[model samples]
Target chain A: MTIVLEKPAPARSGPGAPPPHDDTPARGARALRALGRLSRLTLTRSVVVLALFALWELAPRWELADRTFLPPFTEVAAAWWELALDGRLWENTEASLVRSGLGFGLAVLCAVPLGLLIGWYRPLADLLNPLLELFRNTAALALLPVFILLLGIGETSKVAIVLFACTWPILLNTVSAVRTVDPTLIRLARSMDLSAPRLLQKVVLPAALPTVFTGIRLAGGTAILVLVAAEMVGAKAGLGFLINSSQYNFAIPQMYAGIITISALGLLLNQLLLWAERRLTSWRPQPRG
Target chain B: MTAKINLRAVSKAFPARGGRESVLALDGLELDIGAGEFTVVVGPSGCGKSTLLDLLGGLDRPTSGEILLDGAPVTGPGLDRGIVFQQYALLPWRTAAGNVEFGLEATGTPRRERAALAREHLELVGLGGFEDRHPHELSGGMRQRVAIARSLAYDPGVLLMDEPFAALDAQTRESLQDELLRIWERTGKTIVFITHGIDEAVYLGGRVAVLTSRPGRIKDVVPVELGEARAAHADLRSSPEFALHRRQVWQLLHEEVDRAQELEREAVAR
Candidate 1:
């Protein structure tokens, strides 16, 4: 959730190593050892985060920079507590979530069918491919001013910008997923004497799914990023607008708190998408080696 | 008597690389495959064995002449001609049963009947236990079995296998050949199998058609009436009579292989 703009030096030495262990084990024991290693990694990650936060609090108190601009970690945490007690933080977070969800949902709904058509029908692809390339290359953020002019600086403009930003990745992903499916599979379907609709339903869509899921995941990230930028432009609600207002009003701790909430929301959405991907692709075998 | 497949002076030619001269894959290739017959076609690489199968299966059109199934000219791919490729082209996304069901679905068979038929075909191929498994989960031999089962599920009049066991290891290849013969015998379907392996051709075919080099023409159709070597592919491989048939087919095909190699050298020289 921390918005670390600066990169820190990479960690080298860890706390301690376990005592020299036996190399040989039964299959069951080896599996348990792997699980143990995973837990250890999780433990180490939390410790590292705690250490970094401790440094953030101590260094600011020790006069690392002007405390007015860069508040101590404790001050930011206190500001977060105040926001939570007043219930505005959750309201802002929920507003941003709603915007992102609506935009991303719209993008997916529009992209998939269009992408499937473009991918499956060669003549359509031939006609529209150039236009698609042009639009995909044109930055979605670049259309923000235009959207504002057309729709005004309200929720609609912001949602539209998010949709625009998120659409390309999903559309392109769907196209590539369909296009890159093994030709042998298509030929096999045809040899089976499948109708065009049956071929698309049975052969094309399932094969394209893994790549489409990947695109959707990327689109999720894009949606969050675009939503924040759109909210920063002009919005009365949402964490992004909170961040903007806090900075303008010289509430440094509150600004940092808003930034932290946005980061957390992004991380949480990514994790949720990852879980969905795992659930959908359950047939994919675990790595053996 | 219904001749399962009849090709009348079939010819197929591919357009050569950006030139007036076309590459003739087949020329005046006349053949008749009867019901319950196992015919193997042996040819050097690029001698158009696959092209001939394509023509028979209505996968591609012969540039001249006709390919007929039961006296009717083939218009396009149909369920009457089922093909098994060397690569075992089962859709990777689908499970073994799903792959079998694809053809049934395409042909608009009732769902319950299709499921029963798919099960029966898989059982016939000895892949009964692997129905829910995807292509990736199965071994190469198992995958080919699934493909063969899929083809058979359609109950095609003729099964055309284009080197179905070519990608298999020698042991798997021999075993699959035995399975194929058992299935062919049980179903009483006509089969036209293609292979470059001399031993395989002799082991599987009642009649072996040896083909000449590019612009391929049939050189000979050597018939093997070894009743003792009929079904057991493993035992047939070790028999002296099987060796004699292999030698005869090899002799018929050797000149074609040499001619093909010479032609290849000439093309590479250019």
Candidate 2:
């Protein structure tokens, strides 16, 4: 694609000369050109990924490692198919997704408004800074045992851990985002006689949104991480529990399937958040670099 | 008839950070701008030209004096005065038209009316078709044009501008200066524009007020008598009368620049 696109020789230069506006290429030629460009761009990347999968599939079969411990990619796919046919994988995935959704939703609900207030009001920020810092510094996973102790090894404790893990990124990012809005923008708003609430609604919030969405994306990853870990602790039905039990029972193929499902879920969630961010900030100029 | 804006003994001070003494930005600065007059202020950097505009715009209060709009004491930022900042402070999240409509929105103008006014102002600034473009999408000159449109859309009696063209390229700056003069004449709005450029002051205003170094005070008010030719003649900037006015303003500003440098050196030494 680069080779084809970079070749430049068609010069139509002169003062008052019209730009070359030929758009009369045949349909077949245009389609072939697009296909050639697509293959040039994507073929190498696809080859590399497929080579890794081929290695995974062939390694154990050639007795390069113990098949029982290191199952071939085919075995994992077979296990995934079996689980899907019986609906067990879907059930576990649905359970995990629901828990993640609830926890992340709660975190966003509480954190954004709190962050805005703390950022906007200096006195509140000063009062909360030390406490928030202490909590944020404490590893969220480290608090899992305490959460289990206080709330018990149930859905409550699992959701609480996810909430705890997700809240800080969203809150801290939002606080900084609100605090660092362009001072000139605020001055302009004030010059226009925009009241405090109107200024926040119209200028501060929108300006902070791109940063806030960044925080949300980070929190989305954190939520999934914490959710899986929490599910591993005394959970009966979840992707994390499936992986944990499969390993104990020597079901290596099933374990790999669970791991793949978790990673795929995370990727899907990240993409969704990215789409939301793009929609919300469409007014922003496309990034130059 | 009363002046549109009256600044009587206006002074502004900023409290020092750390253990340093408080700095006086403006000291007993007095000036009067008549209704529909175009007044340009030129001074050394940090001569409180912006501070003067802020006081007149009612965005900042004078420390020990009064600023009056017409007969009323200026209290706070109001809809009657519009300000165009040097940074072209249009909201990045808003399109050109939305930014132009900001003041109208604040004043509770109906949506349809605001849209029409915004479009009209955008057209006036030669940005008619670019109304939907965001600030980041526009060039610096275009963004400043949108800022000018935003300031004008609300129909303010007084327009206060602080070096609105300082960031643009020379060509863009000259063209924008011409556009601003045309707008000022057509709207008949009392304008107090601040700049560090002596030539810009001579080109834009009927009267140029040269300010001293901090604590800044009005050093001289030079009336420009370029007549109608100044506005109508494209070659007026290169004309001898224009040079004379530019040189006169530069001469007053040169002394203040030296004074400002000396003050800066003393502060650094202290």
Candidate 3:
């Protein structure tokens, strides 16, 4: 007499886990009630966002600040629409995404494997860690001029700076992640006569994944932020370039549109990474509301 | 059965830490576990009971002397020995069956056979429908059952349990204890169950080994004589024979517990 749900059984451990102990349940009715409540919560939560939008629209229309500089929300949206329709925004966004993708991809390739090795062996970590600490403490943007001087102000410098900024969080976090795998699990694996390699592959990696993925998500955000700053300095086309050019050319609404697009891009990238994290680490009990 | 496991003058010492003197956990300890015997080792909090189990499991070497499994010396962890830790120590990310399959996979059993064996072991521990549940999804009792199933699935001859049910509630503990007895009867494992509970030792052990306080040595061994009732796994806790055995083991342990507490008190005061 067992009923298997499609979703992995969310046991009573998680926040939104089913209340199996409760007797009075028409499953369909309960789901509807939950959905209704969720919709209500969504509406209530949107009030703040809507209120902020209203403030932006009214403050500038009423001349709270100079309308020439701080145009209303609608004007910015309209300017964004024009740019999007003409594909100007698209062109710049593609350039920015390409730079970010290359830099971030390279960082992952270099950092994760390096982090694993440095974390596993004590002697290697001892040899490399002081050098890593020295570099990690030196912020990436502080080396912006140095990067431009070395790699030049082309796409290379922008991508290189983004890679530099993204590397530390990914690498350092991975090292700690491997280091902090519960010793109990290691003992259990050892008791099973697992070889050293098998122990790393099976026990250490899976245990360290949730933390390691956390590092990756942090780096994803870093990739965007650092790339934008680098682009502002010397890129021909990117969200940062668009924003800078619009401000200089006195196209205030276009600048606001570019700034808003950057925020949206950051939010979307975070969401995508979070989705991947959820897919891969589904074994972990997720915090639900 | 002859002594399947043997410890001859076994001792372990912890190196001095933070300018403190070295702590001797065990000294001149002698013990023997017969093949297919349910030998429960009971002691005070700091009597090196766990250290003894670690030595037998070959996770740690004895500081002096030696531990022997069969005729050979115990050198390191092997599939022949399985340990059930106090904390359940389950990989939280793995399902019950997946966890059971961990050892099977280590043994290089094919994927399909591993699943079948894992399911069989999970069923043996009365977790048939719980094969897919993660450790967090299960209750404390259920989690420990999965751990037991996992240790047993690898077909280890000697199972070293270090307070496996210590974290469980009283009712869960008793039920698990009964379940363990049934499993032992079925499997015929050479089990060395460690506990601080006198009643548990009396109930589970064919012979209970009472260990003395800090710098532990074998204080006494009480041969449980519950006979027919124990064999049936019946209502033996209330029986007069069970009472006598409980009292006997408690008496042997009471003095050592006090001595260990006094030493702990002095150390904490310092």
lDDT of 2: 0.89
Error of 3 at A85 (Å): 2.2
Model 2 bad stretches (over 4 Å): A1-23, A26-30, B231-233
Instruction: Kindly list the per-residue Cα lDDT of model 1 for residues A242-276, writing each as its tens digit.
Output: 99999999999999999989888888989999778
Sort the candidates on lDDT, descending order. 3, 2, 1
Candidate 3: which stretches are off by over 4 Å? A1-35, A122-130, B19-21, B231-233
Q: Could you tell me which residue pairs clash in candidate 1?
A: none
Chain B global fold similarity (TM-score) for predicted model 1 against the true chain B: 0.96
Q: lDDT tens digits, residues A50-102, model 2?
A: 89889999989999988888889988999999999999999999999988999
The candidate with the higher lDDT, 1 or 3, is 3
Runs with alpha carbons beyond 4 Å of true place in candidate 1: A1-35, A44-48, B231-234
In model 3 chain B, the worst 10-residue window by lDDT is B226-235
C-alpha lDDT values of all predictions: 0.86, 0.89, 0.90
- Model 1 is docked with a DockQ of 0.49
Could you tell me the C-alpha RMSD of candidate 3 in Å?
6.3
Candidate 1 per-residue lDDT, tens place, B1-270, comes to 457778799889899998889999999988888878999999999899988887777768999999888888998888887889888888776789988987777778899998899899999999987789988899999999999998899788789899999999999998999899899889988999999999989888989999998888988899888886555555767788898898998888888889999999999999
In order of DockQ, best first, we have 2, 3, 1
Model 2 alpha-carbon miss at residue A145, Å: 1.5
